[model samples]
Target: MFDLVIRNGLLIEADGVTKADLAIDGEQIAAVGLSLQGRREIDATDCYVLPGAIDPHVHLQMPLAGMVSTDDFRTGTIAAACGGVTTIIDFVEPKPGQSMLEALALRQEEAKNKVAIDYGLHMTIPTWHANAADGLKEVPAVVEAGCLSFKMYQAYEGMMLDDVALLRALTAVGEAGGRTVLHSETGPVLDYLRAEALAEGHVEPIWHAYTRPAPLEASAVHRAAELADLASCPLYIFHVGCQESVEAILQARSRRIDIWGETCPQYLLLNAEEHLGGPNGALYVCAPPLRSVEDNRAMWHALAQDALQVVSTDHCPWTFEEKQQPDFTRIPGGVPSIEARLSLVHHFGVNQGLLTLERWVEVCSTNAARWMGLTRKGRLAPGYDADIVIFDPARIKKITPATLHEAAGWTPYDGMEVCGWPRTVLLRGKVIVEDEQYVGAPGDGRFIPRRPSALS
Candidate 1:
């Protein structure tokens, strides 16, 4: 007999959904067929059994602007588990003059015994110089250590890379069989606009969105795509927020460039004008701030059309008091959504007819795995890790900070009604969440070593 079995559930995969029984032996799915039995069984009648979602981006306890985000590895992954995420990919930002491998080791130390679910790391190229032989030479070793991906920024002051350096770094990573993930925003333009706004006495939260308008993001995406093409590198764009950026991805893919795009729930559901103007507006402050209603519509359409391959939560969070700043620039920029992504997407994307069930699974789980090289973590087939989520379609609730596991004191989606919450979650055949309450322990999670990107 198998170790455990989930019976009479509708199994949802990226390709299709069907009624089946899933059996697990040890930590892997043993079979998916009719009449499967196990020594221990869970009744899943009327539930949707899906592969646990994989959040490809998050920043737990990330330091920014002299303050660290509220959720650390332990709290953050617990929240993720409650929301049905079985794996997450977080970044490693090396200190100034630090080697990439050194930063990776330090980051692993921080999360070693704290994570509540499996996780992988992506090395961030803080700054790249053509003459910097030592830094570039570590790409292959880092990849060999199982990172398999690198992050490059085009917009931060100290972290941004110039075109030449970016191209060179992309080429180095490509030659090492790894993919390059980019944060596409034009730094100089943003600085100029923010200075103009602040000089004009426009210090409200709305100015944050006004200063970093959609065109800057689109232009940066276009530039990054061109550089990736020149380097023959596989590229993944993070937090794509507008239609112009979506069009840029479409154009690049039309030419057979190996490129992928991701959008977050904020860009898909919240609009700038409505969510960024009140006294509490600072709470929604985040980089590449929310976009217009038309942009939200465009984001949904792009996901449905497969122009965007992943929908991840850039799950960085700050406390409410920490966000209360006199100037918009002083406000820490990030919002918490690690525990809300799946339900929000299921309510707004699937229940509202914007995304099919299969498409939802693809964007929320399968595609992220395929692109990020988490080969065994994102599927429920035999021999794959038995990470699963059982969602109750009829469950409904209004969101409130009190009901969430994020250490942040508030949420951007407060009071929004949503359906289809995860009632059970399994990580490697171990039940970690039952009835939406996390039963997992700290240090139960292990580091996931990734393979080269499947897209590569």
Candidate 2:
């Protein structure tokens, strides 16, 4: 007999939707057929059963431009579970004097008892340091150790890689069986813009995005794509927002470059116009600051064209207290998103006809898993991990911090109405969230490694 059975639920994925009785044995899926018997049966009469979300780009806990994000692995992963995500791939920072392996080990130890679902780490190569060089050398072992990918910054003063090192790291990951991910932006140009903006007395909260214009992001996107092409490396651009950036990605993709781009719920749901509105204006501030509605429309079109491959939260949450502490030049650059990415996408995209249900599965779950190399993290089938969300298709819910599971205590998505919500979440066949509450322990989360692909 199967251990658990999810009955009468519609299985939605990249392929299509079908009615099935999905059975689970221990942690893996046991079967998907009619009349499956199990120790427990959940009647998912009108629910949608999709693979749990795999959030590939997130900063669960880490230093940012100045302050740290509000969510730790424990709180962030629980919020993720409440949102129906089962797997997360977050970054691990390098210690000033530690080897990449040393830093990675330390990070794993820290996360060992701090997560509520499966997790993995992406090594962020801070800059062109000797340790970065040494770290790149062990990437093969890192990949073998289940870390599997490297990340680079192009904006933070001390963290962004120089042009030569960026190209070199891309090439090294290409050769070392790992993927190279980029946070694209022109640091120097942005710095110049911010100085000019602030020197001329343009320091209002709304001026943040204005200081770093879309052209800067677009130029960096082109340059990064060129570098990735030069190295013959696989590229993944994190948190893509502007039209020009997406266009650059599309143009490169047309030439058959193995490059993937990601856009977040913020870009899809909020635009530059909101940043300039009201007394609560400071709430919308984030790096790659939200762009115009036209940019948002263009990004939506990009998704419809399959030019944008993934949708993620870029799930970094920060307090207004800490984020607002920076002067115009140093204000932290992120938004609160751990609990809102999926529902916002569903409310706006799926309901408005911008995304078909299949595409929703692709953008929110499947593609993220495929890109991050989490093999068993983003599907529903026999032998796949029983990480699933039982979604109520017609349930109407408002997004507010009052209902969040993240330690951040608040959400920027307050007051937004959604027609569907995840009412149940399972991680490796264990119920983590049921009826909108977390039921799992923190240490239950495990580390995930990418399966061999271009990273091989």
Candidate 3:
């Protein structure tokens, strides 16, 4: 008999959903058909059984401005698992003198014993210098060690790469059979704007949006896309929040460039106006600060029109106390969204008719796995990993900090009610979450080795 079976559920996939039963043997799907038999079975009537969501962008235990992000691997992956996200791809930052391979080893060590769900890493180059090319030349070793993507920043101080550095690194990564992921924003302009805002005493949280305007992000996207094209590299832009950025991505794709764009829940459902509310507004502060309602509408249309291909949380949670600073620029900028991401997408996208169930799964899970070269993941079929979510479509859960698993102690989406919730979550046929309670061990998660995608 199969190890486990889920019966009487609507199986949701990228192409469509089917009323079927699923069987799992060992850690992989053993069968997907009518009336499957197993040693143990779950009654999934009135629910949707989807391949577990894959959050491609997240920062667990990230260090920023002298304070570490509150969500360590244990808590962050617990939140991910409880929310039906079985896999997360987080960044691996190489110190100034550290080789990419060294950074990957250190990052893997950090997550190996703490993450409660499956995870992967994206090697990130913090800065470029005389030995930058030499450091990147080892990218093939890192990719061979299981990380197929590299990240470069064009925004943050101490992290931003010059155009020369970005082009060189992209070329090296492309030559290494890896993808180049970027954080697109003009760093100097943003620095100047922040100084201007502070000099004029525009220190409120709302000024965060004014300092890092949409045009700056768009210009950076255009430049980065051009560099990727010139280098003949595959590019993936993360946390794109504005229409102009989307336009830049589309314009590149128009020329047959291999480029993919990602936008987060904050960009899709929240607005910059939230920063005008009060002291609490600082909680909404993040890089590529939230944009206008027009931008939000444009993002929904773009996702529907296939102009944008992925929706990740970019989940970097910090505490409320961490965000109370008068200097908007100094406020720890990241919002807690992991626990509510899947439910919010279901409520707003599928339930509201903005996206079909198939499209929702594609953007949240399938596309990420495919783009990241997670070959056996992001689908619900025989031989695929049995990471699955039993979602109760009729359940109503209002988002609240007290109910969340992120260590941040607050949620930007507090008071928002979502229609669907993950009733059960399984990682490779082992139940990690059931009835919203975490039932997994700290080291239950395993490291996922990734291969280079053909997009390169």
Give the candidate number with the greatest TM-score: 1
lDDT on C-alpha atoms for all candidate structures: 0.92, 0.82, 0.88
lDDT of 2 by residue, 85-122 (tens): 88888887886765778888888887898899898889
The positional error of residue 220 in candidate 2, measured at the CA in angstroms, is 1.0
Worst 10 residues of 2 by lDDT: 127-136
Which pairs clash in the backbone of model 1? none
Model 1 agreement with the true structure over 1-456: per-residue lDDT tens digits:
899999999999999998999999999999999998799999999999999999999999899879999999999999999998999999999887788889999999999999999999999987743337767898899999999989998887878888888998999998999899899999888989999999999999999999998988999999999999999889999999999999999999998988999999999988778988876889888888998999999999999999999999999899999999999988998899999999999999999999999999999999999999988977879999999999998999788998889999899999999988999999999999998889989887888989974543
Q: What is candidate 2's CA lDDT for residue 420? A: 91
* lDDT value, candidate 2, whole model: 0.82
Clashing pairs in 2: 117-445, 177-455
Q: Tell me the spans in candidate 3 whose CA falls farther than 4 Å from its real position.
A: 129-133, 453-456
Provide the global lDDT of candidate 3 against the true structure.
0.88
Judged by lDDT relative to the true structure, which candidate is superior, 1 or 2?
1
